[model samples]
Target: MYRIIGIIVTLLFIMSILLAALALLVSRISLNRHVWLAGFFAGILDFFYMPLKYFFYKFSDPRILDKWMVSLKNISNRNSFKKADRRMIIAPHCMRHMECPASSKRTGIQCVSCGKCIFSRLREDASKYGYDLYIVTGSSFVKHVIKEKSYDAALLIACDYELNKVMMGLKGKRLITYGVPMLNDGCFNTEVEYEKVIETLELFSN
Candidate 1:
């Protein structure tokens, strides 16, 4: 019995190592081209994410892991996101203008399109594309948004860390998410490429 247990443990350890290696490879390669087993590799990375993040945190840039994971997930979710009839855009409050006059509620920020921030343009585009826009303060507000209405897909905009964080949080909620990472990270005045946002909306628009 002891010998059998030892053999099983050895095999499990080896399998874990191989899966982690494959996941890393897929992440790196997906940056340039489409990957075949994107969903599988993404699952592997998600399973090992905490440990891998700690490893990167100690010796390397953890943001790279988040960026790669976001890419892989986007590839995995593309088809389904495109097919989703009900979609929403979840944006971060940090991207709003400093003197912006948006109000905070349980659902999220209500953008009045006052022309002081990118959100004005985003709200217009979101309406044009038939996507509900939620300008959230943080990740925790996602649950409230989820409860507020029914959505089959979500287009997320944030830094890589927050994008990956929200993606993982929404993993089992029966929602498909595609992340567009922002140009920079900060508490306020962060920015994203407007063209990229519009491109994503147009690509997946029904």
Candidate 2:
């Protein structure tokens, strides 16, 4: 398990660095002059990157990917999604922000497992629902998962700023998103809330 996880992490790291470099290159070449065009191009990159990265994910687990992909397709095509039950919560564990302040200005790194924040609670909810909940980063990766697997929907907890970016990338997916606070002035503890997440899902579930 450790070896598999290690390999996955290493591959993901490489992919992130390469993609970040490409984005930086785009910024440098345009010199940030064509702001609107650069933004559009970035969106294109995100949408296109979804399928490409999904290939890697599927290769990691062919059977799981194959079954989930078909399920996801049906969910995406649904009009009401009333039959959906299981869902995954995508929250930023400690990767979304640089520092904290409200709870003590402790960055996500300070999470001490007191089980008070959104992390533990949401994880519990996910387990309760039999959902594969993960506190992960990367809207790109989320998009990949959406494309490759069938989930009832996602409860994505991201900062307001990244919310737009993530929405842009995930525009057509069938997720019911709940935008939460990030950065300073938020709980400042990097903790997310299960009740709030449930509230978001309830909006579409009923």
lDDT of each: 0.95, 0.48
lDDT of 1 at 120: 93
lDDT of 2 by residue, 1-206 (tens): 99999999999888876775465355344432333344444444454445534664766633232222222322332333445665665666553244322232221222333554555555565666555655544454565456545776555566544544554555566564334434332433554454656765555453
Model 2 TM-score relative to the real fold: 0.41
Q: Whole-model lDDT for model 2 versus the true structure?
A: 0.48
Query: For model 1, what is the C-alpha lDDT against the true structure?
Result: 0.95
Question: Best-fitting candidate, measured by TM-score?
Answer: 1
* TM-score for each of the candidates: 0.97, 0.41
Candidate 1: Cα lDDT at 205: 76
Best by lDDT: 1
Shift in Å, residue 175, candidate 1? 0.8
- Error (Å) of candidate 1 at residue 182 is 0.3
**For model 1, how does the per-residue alpha-carbon lDDT over 94-129 read when each residue is reduced to its tens digit?**
999888887899988999899998999999999899
